[model samples]
Target: MKAILLHGVTAFLLSFSALGQMQSFSLQEVKVTGGAFKNAQDVDLRYILSLNPDKLLAPYLIDAGLPLKAERYGNWESSGLDGHIGGHYLSALAMMYASTGNAELKKRLDYMIDQLAQCQAKNGNGYVGGIPQGKVFWERIYKGDIDGSSFGLNNTWVPLYNIHKLFAGLRDSYEFGGNQQAKQVLIGLGDWFAELIRPLSDDQIQQILRTEHGGMNEAFADLYILTKNQKYLETAQRISHRAILNPLVQKQDKLTGLHANTQIPKVIGFEKIAMLTENAKWSEAARYFWQNVSQTRTVAFGGNSVREHFNPTNDFSSMLKSNQGPETCNSFNMLRLSKALFLDKNDPSYLDFYERTLYNHILSSQHPQKGGFVYFTPIRPNHYRVYSQPETSMWCCVGSGLENHTKYSELIYSHSANDLFVNLFIPSTLHWKEKSIQLTQATEFPYKNQSEFVLKLAKSQAFTLNIRYPKWADDVEVMVNGKLYPTSAQPSNYIGIRRKWKTGDKLSVRFTTSTHLEYLPDGSNWAAFVHGPIVLAAKTSTADLVGLFADDSRMGHETKGKLYPIDKAYMLIGDTDTYISKVKSVGNLKFSLDSLTLQPFYEVHDARYQMYFQTFTQNEFDAQKAKQRQQETEALAMEARTVDKVSCGEQQPEVDHSYKGEKSDAGYDDDGRFWRNTRSYMSYQLQNKGFAGKTLEISFSGNLKTEEVGFFLNDRAAEIIAVKDRVISVKTDNTELITLKIVSENGRPTPRFHQIRLMK
Candidate 1:
């Protein structure tokens, strides 16, 4: 293979095994012909075009000390996570241009690259970012004046994570859009970043890594591949968080309390670096993580985590109850990781997960008609999702959502040296330029159980065509030219057929799908209906969708609708053995369960829906109903009484409440609870919006040494009312904004605090 030149440097050569594995077609090499995915692609294109690049460029321009063309977007863009969507937009425009050959997307991508190049020129040190006070922040890091938390570093919101998006965007623009200018900008930015962290010790770098830095290792690894600079590769290794990597390398599951999206990207980086370096230990660790997360933590729809953090694998009650369900960004990153793993290992199993998540989570995350993106897909009964409006919302999910639908053609077809793999059955046309092969796949998959492939070739050529036999498919049949092709292939593997393929030749595949009940991974009583790779959900109601279309509010992406009682949700009653039999087929990939209609979850939108249903035998129904009612009553009462609350140790909750600390630590306990404690001091700003709060409740995991802990509210000493059942109650005034501080007195450590609530 010839070494390509990038920014005056030769490209690094990959391992023979990594290079020879399943090779994915570029988005430009395949096109979505027609289907729901095509509609989604169209919608995503409109959403991409709806945004003004200048507005998205404002932050970068401001950081560059240049004139702004338009105002910065609100929500996340105007907030601390500025220019993040701009980076995602670059990627979206590049991939969308590749997928659809849309001229407008290409134009916008070129314009953005040009603008970014100008900004890079102005910065002069190869640094161009929209991070709030970008220069000063880098200067602080350069001087080793770093203070880091889970979601913040130096009192900024994920600046490292924020900038990694730009890194990825520039990489994608060059890789997909073939923009040389993006390549130069990326190299310049990479050089600046490398220098920025050069002076810091590994310990200081790890401290910075404690914050949510999105795939920094992956970015540097890609940089190494582009420039073949060992320094870039070393930087990648240096930044890979040892706390996370060491546990994974030892085949440990220390990921329970970690932020789901944060770790997923790091693992993606791990896999990438492992593949490039042929590091067996890192590769094994990456695979172990994939197996653990995919099998244990992921929901039926292939999304993982609850409220942005991984809950205990054995208990999913919090996931089933919280309005903050599996986030779209998690699935988005998971898919990227899955794609990388599949390409590296040529594993057919990864394709199974990729297909499942693509259909259920990523495909379902967009508004089909109105052209918007969903942040969270709640499993909470009667809960809905909020979609992003282009001019109003700029959340991380909106950024990932833009790129999700634009690249449905990515994994449709892949190839090795002499073989072609039909990975997914999405309706698309693949142009294999090297071999002069044009194969068009036509299917209404998950709707119609059959797919047909027609090949248009320049001449008769022999190559093995590998068709994936999905695990959920049964009695799969493949035909060539209207004749049955005899083959023996087990599920979760591929059936390869090698023959001379000429123009006008046809290949057909058919499979059977069955409706079945899939319980949650925790072995809980709750289950979801699945038809093949598609998850089925029932629309519960249309009422109380308060933020259906998100506004510019910080938490607007969350569905603030009323959460119905868990006992009141539709449940599967009677024998578990008869549950699948009771699901009478009513339509394509649709069924009737009791009085409710279940359709493909991607099709069930614009209303409140239930993906998981509680299962109860007739004998246990009444008792379980009473238990759930009592639990719900107590929980709802607390939520009703509380003016504001924060779950300590969790990223979003702490960041949302403006949690700050000195000499602090947090982790998930063996009892499946999160706690944070400080040896010095910890503080959080909570909003008592209604002035109805009379008392403050601090829940601790274990007994607190009250003598060693000092509590203050609004900069004044707080009066402790009572300490019972591990909860400390304190008297509070009618302060709208309460700044509660917990200080460790006399150099003594504070107790592990789980939650803080302002109550009536």
Candidate 2:
């Protein structure tokens, strides 16, 4: 009987051990030593910590002032500050402080907490904000009349959104930074939130949530984790925006027109809830949304959309037509979501997207000289980038810009206790706490397709090391201890090698390149030019075009208003037989443009360019290549004529240009010519000249601010005010003689007008 009992006990013990292994939930202790986040000095900790308390808390404290003071967003009677910004600031502060221990940051955080406690006391409820208009906005939302057409109550959600940022910040501070007081503050805020919502039914709550609110669910889930309170979890579940949540959970693409970043935080909350509750469907739903977006919708730069709205799938032909595409903040949130998914699945594909965006978009978003962020990375053929000012431009990009440069260390290394994953090839060092091992990765990467890893040991430890081979690399080679090893995983997957790694072990990897062509969803035959992972663009000479007007300085010149075909602009000088050869080979992965000899698209600045082109087959190319040559010959001939004849001409040179007028009362001359008076502002009139037998070119010259040139013809309005170095050209049917008119928004006449001409 004793022997039988012993056997059963041993079996039970074995089963328990297996269950423990399966249920492990702790995040592996992955420490980063190098990369973007490495400290330059001992005071770096203090500087990082200062991000929250000294920087973030200082603003709120100053707003609050002495006694029960909080800084006013604007006027409580008029301008109401939203909670989203505040929430992010607080969250960032808390997280930064937690990541780096700084006493100053802690002190500022503590003081702000005390001040908030006082404000809560004074309000006689859980309410605490600088804005008193929040109460009125909440009442209006409760009454179901939020259209944002009015001024006062329409601004309600702003404050709540800001508070959400604060709540999230506090939570991160507690969880990641080890600030217990942060947890206390978060719990109080959660309790207050519960009290505010308990009186309203689900229907009423849903009505109140219809406005443009940020991720309230994310904050509630965070609170749940801090307190382990079931009520907080319930709140998070209830606050899930059903419009977004229902479609996402149902595996539908109702996300076409939805705000990009606004919806991401809610899904993040869903991911957290799925983890906490062990709900398989919820986890699947979250993962599905991420996969669909990160894979199908993203552009080569790891961004999507042409106008902040998701265009129809596969119809990227219209991608370069708008200025509002791919908000920087959207990239920020998408990357955050990617990180979360990476932790959950341990997949290498997520890292691929992360690396692409980090290099092409996020890294380039910041100006290298000024450290200011670009508002938009314009893909429009001739549009220039607008950058944010250091002090004045507090746009959405600014908020994201603050956090983007600080978190590069987060993805450098990740592990699963027994295996270390080297994800990104950024120069960095990793200290694996569990194995007591330090691994240093040094590489120029993407630029120089080689990376080396050096192992350091306090004591020799045995572990598996997994290195990711990017999807762009084709001929990848890996070596260990001077012995070559074969790898089976394709690019964009991990090459895992388990071994008893000793001190002084070195691993070397070499990645080769290949040329790839990506097709747009629309059957427009448009293709993106890519070499390996890098997207290339044809660089053109920088033109000082104004925002909307054309320059009259080159009036009557033959070069003005000439539409040079793209083939002529970007001369294809390299061997067309092999597309890889067409990519001008520079040493390493870097290549120069064959047209203007400029750097890659990501490096090009202050230049008009094209990244996508319409490719033709060999037979078609042979037929069109001659025409392309002829067009180039004509352009060069025209350029020589202008220089020889117009350079010394006395009369204002007559340059032929065309402009289409809008349907409004802006009139044009019989030849479709319009004039702007230099003294009294006069709007140009338009008259449609019937297209007789052939296409006619309408040309005009005016000296006005680029912002002042507005041309309207055929129900279309074209502002040529900011015509940089390139002349305006458009092709239309001969039946419509498009009228051309230039008008200034400020009603100011142009400084000079040379002549207007129309020709067939």
Candidate 3:
């Protein structure tokens, strides 16, 4: 490995300087080839260009309404109207246009820029956003109106983050799309931000920093690079989140349970700042963060998190309990971070994480039908995916949903100043214009264990073709022109084959599969099952219980359980550990299931499924098998008559008191889900609704603590209290009765109901 010489701004400056000063040096250029199944940039641009930008942008434009023209934060009802997000779209558009010379995309960007310019002009200042309530929001923050005791701010930095996206878009337009008006608009926007913050005290500034803000510093650093302006660089440094960067720079591991994507963009800014300033400490810090996250925290699916927040390392057993795990947007951001590290160090380990995530998380996010996306990939076995709706559910998945399918061409191939690196084996063709070479890689990897690449040459040229030998491939064989060459000396590293290539040169690569158990880092004796690059999940019956239609409300709430404990009713095999009689091979592919019949989750789509089963040791395995047989015999003997219900010994408590307790001490029965305890003080059990209905009325014969009564039904809040005196009454009209829970305030415990009725 060669030593990295460039540091800080010097590194960026030197790239340009070297191109200008040295006769041998030239501008390092990149472009996508217009061929079938090429690099991500190519495939991504193709998909993006195909979309009607007007259709996508129309909703936002209308949503922004007058606030877009007024240059103010609009009503809280419309969040997408904020300028920052519009900027991101423009940036993505500009990049797509640069990658492919699409005139329609350029036209859409121009219209957006013109509208934003009008908004800025109307404000009589450089301020541009859809937030009409900006003044009121800031006032509330200054008045110390803290909500939920979490932070002291209104709407946080969401508006700012959105604006940053616009700034980035303008920057990309100028640098990549050759749009000068975009640059002018961005400069005006930057000036507005500088003036806005200049009046605030350091304490006020710190208070504002508590909210989640994107990479504002990185955008400024990019501005400095483009214009060679010192002020821009200074602003970039100032915008760096000291709270996040300070801890990371000190090599501290305080990232447990933190929002993954929220902190990643800040590190990207740190990386940019380090590149511009030539700060070795910053560079080391950025690298350390990337390495730690990529290596220790990731899952077999190449993603991290259990509920949109990072969990403790190796403790993924609890991942399946919630549907909100490993959000796709987080994976998208992680891949971007991976590309940055790979470009800097060209480490094979980075590629490993990239491939794993791309296959398991990113590819899986794309819906097979509508091209919509999933918000999270639940790691719980037997669970199906919950996809985002086209217009209704425009959450974080919406942003990533747009980017995910468009950029499959970007990661297929990368090049340094001289060498070509083929990192992924997606079906794609690469055209290296400078080298006069075209390389096409063809394979359906994980589905098939082999891939082949053919090189087409306008003329013979000398270059190194580096092929990645994936970490999962126990043995890899590389053949050129039907002759097998000795394997590369390093495992889990790229094999650099330097040769003079001409037209029709061929390379065939083969990867062998091997099953491995990955033990959890925690002291728990559990492990995740993996075969080759694919993660295997146990298949169970969740599909039949829920309808698979488009209108099915059960899609998102399908399988409700943790990953470890197998539900006895749903378990097809009596014991998960000893259930598999054999691991069989169908040609080159090998599969293992309970009773020799399990399949991968991706393969069992549209069917009820489960993955990740318990593995048992030899002693426990044989014992469980014998016990299962005995239970099977007993089940046969009991088949003569139906045993509908079983009863346990009942307990009776003696009550001697004749006096009645004060009715004022009892809380209101909101849905008849709560009642007074005759034996002791108040106590409550949250009730699960057995059926679906609309109206719920609770009647109680007692003086009620009206203010104390509250109900939470299906996680939606409802407050029902007695309006008058002794008789308490409450009612509500709702169709679904999932779970109804009631509680009291002022430390008074709620009571269990004696009689509960559901109204249709």
Candidate 4:
């Protein structure tokens, strides 16, 4: 009863011993030779080849006293966060090499490892990093002289976060790239770092953990797994922040106002330590975090957070209104965490969210034909996104985006001591080398809703094969050798067939998919149509796609195009049932709904599409329309007056607007608006193009107490003033441009400033 009532029905699908003992198949054992995954792998390989290796290696070479062969990248590469891309490139090459067996990628992987080894040897103390003056920075932290914040440590731009990339690269190099040399380099680097931090107390380590460290705990836990040493294990446990992990272990939702990506990687570390150390409390913490995020916080697109930070779950207005919506890196990390939880517990719920997110968010992120990756997927009614190029855009999404497509076969199938489980409908083949069993699966799935599996065995074998009955399927029909295998099985569980199987035996499973409307988690009036596991979206228009194809500009990741008035958005013309019933299936994976054309989200690239539709009750349609029209008029007028704007706590915007500050900190508010305030001063240059604006609006959250403020325009200071309004308007007489600055002279911190915009 505990198993059935707590987890899903598949909880008892396997024996207790088998559940704990099962492990993932090696990349070599299972190969994906066909399906849409193979096509994506092709595109990813081409994109990998397009990136210049010499450019990525420039930082390492420069720091190692070696000459640079190629120029470093522009945006993030030349910025303070240098050498991060080199690490992602290494991991991408390693995974691509393992998955595809590409000889060129393997060569590149070996070359990168060799260069890193050279850099490590030159460092003279087993320390290797591409952060400029990183040795000096670590020296300061080693002596207990640390000044840390959300994004900086000891006056450096996320040095720990930057180094975590190298750690991940080394781990992936040995795991997937199959390079023995990388193992030594990785272990040496770990030992070097451990010694540096060995003198620091636990309190100091926790203080350092306040900043974004990019799964350093996860990297340490992985190292423990690799070496079976307790020292690294202790280090991992010591660095795991109690403030974040303790509340989670108690099953609390304290995620609001926190950095989304930073905490996700920490939870990944927690789960890894739990698995390696057999600590159930840590495992529960990870599981609880997953449930809270996947169930209550997630959106219709299977993603959460707005502007790269978690918003209060009770309100999703900002999730729908903000142009900087759910981030691809957050989903990327969530999938990693979901995979870990699923392998640990074998719960159908994890697979449920995994399938939805994979189909809707991950698959839709990449432009099918253009081969560019998306940073943000805005859910705003008539908004769009920007894509990353190989040479120009080196944002965080570009790093994770490179790894997204090459490994689509990650969670397709799993096996135990003598049983196999089919988790996904992706077409692939599994070769169980232990039992000499070869099972191949083929299907167009979600399009055809049926899959056929053929087993090739040299001799008769006896084992149990569990086929997952997805929750989305209405009824599952299974056939053994063209004869109906009669059973009284339902969905949300696995159906196991235990019998003697011979060579060339065949089995077929067909699913009956029924259309249904899924409402937002917060019970908002927004709805999305889900047919089986595929999320259907309607194509809107192809207008004002600013930065649709990104350039080398720092802000290229943002979609700064003109926004359509929300009042003019196409509304559902009927009630909920009528809208669902009227979605007529057209040829191919498309449908016709009134004036809209619906299709699979992953297939609808190069156009603006709507996944969540505005739904109203049959009696309240006219009333809702009237209310929306008035609200949209105010929205349009407010939006039209903005000339230039800057959103704090976001990457591309801050960088593009020449953000410079001292003693500054950033976080998101409960309303999902991001804010950055400083004890010293912070500034962002706004382009007063043609001098059209008459006033400057500096936005801040209400009820926040602040000291007297001094504003600077182009290095000129104004009289100190205290403002209580949410938005403070300052008259400007600038003819061309002005750099806005906020500061406090009393040594007190400035108020939480939301955004700065020029208004007419």
TM-score of 3: 0.70
Which numbered prediction scores highest in lDDT against the true structure? 1
The lDDT per prediction is: 0.88, 0.54, 0.55, 0.81
Per-model root-mean-square deviation over C-alphas: 5.8, 13.7, 11.8, 3.6
Selected candidate, larger TM-score, 1 vs 4: 1
Residue-level lDDT of model 4, residues 1-760, one tens digit each, is 1122221112234433444344677676677777566777778788889998889888888777888889888888877778998898888999888788889999999998998898899887888888987777888899998766666676567788888999999999999889999999999999998999999999899989877888999999989989988899998898898889999998988898777888999999999999988999999999999888888888867878887778787777777877788899899999999999888886756788888898888888887766888888988776777878898988888888899887787778888787777888888888888889998999988789899999999798777777888889888887777867644555666777767788888889998887778887887787788888888887798988877989986667878787776667766766566877888888666888888887887787777767777776757777777787788788777888987788876644665677777778787665667788888888887777789877777888644443377787777764323343687776665657778888876667777888887777
Model 2 scores a C-alpha lDDT of 0.54
What is the per-residue lDDT of model 3 for residues 161-217, given as tens digits with 9 covering 90 to 100? 555666777787776567788788788877767666666566565545544456788
Model 2, runs deviating above 4 Å: 1-84, 94-124, 130-132, 139-160, 521-523, 537-541, 545-580, 598-602, 605-609, 616-760
TM-scores of the models, in the order given:
0.95, 0.69, 0.70, 0.94
With candidate 3 superimposed using the best TM-score fit, by how many Å does residue 583's alpha carbon deviate from the native? 3.4
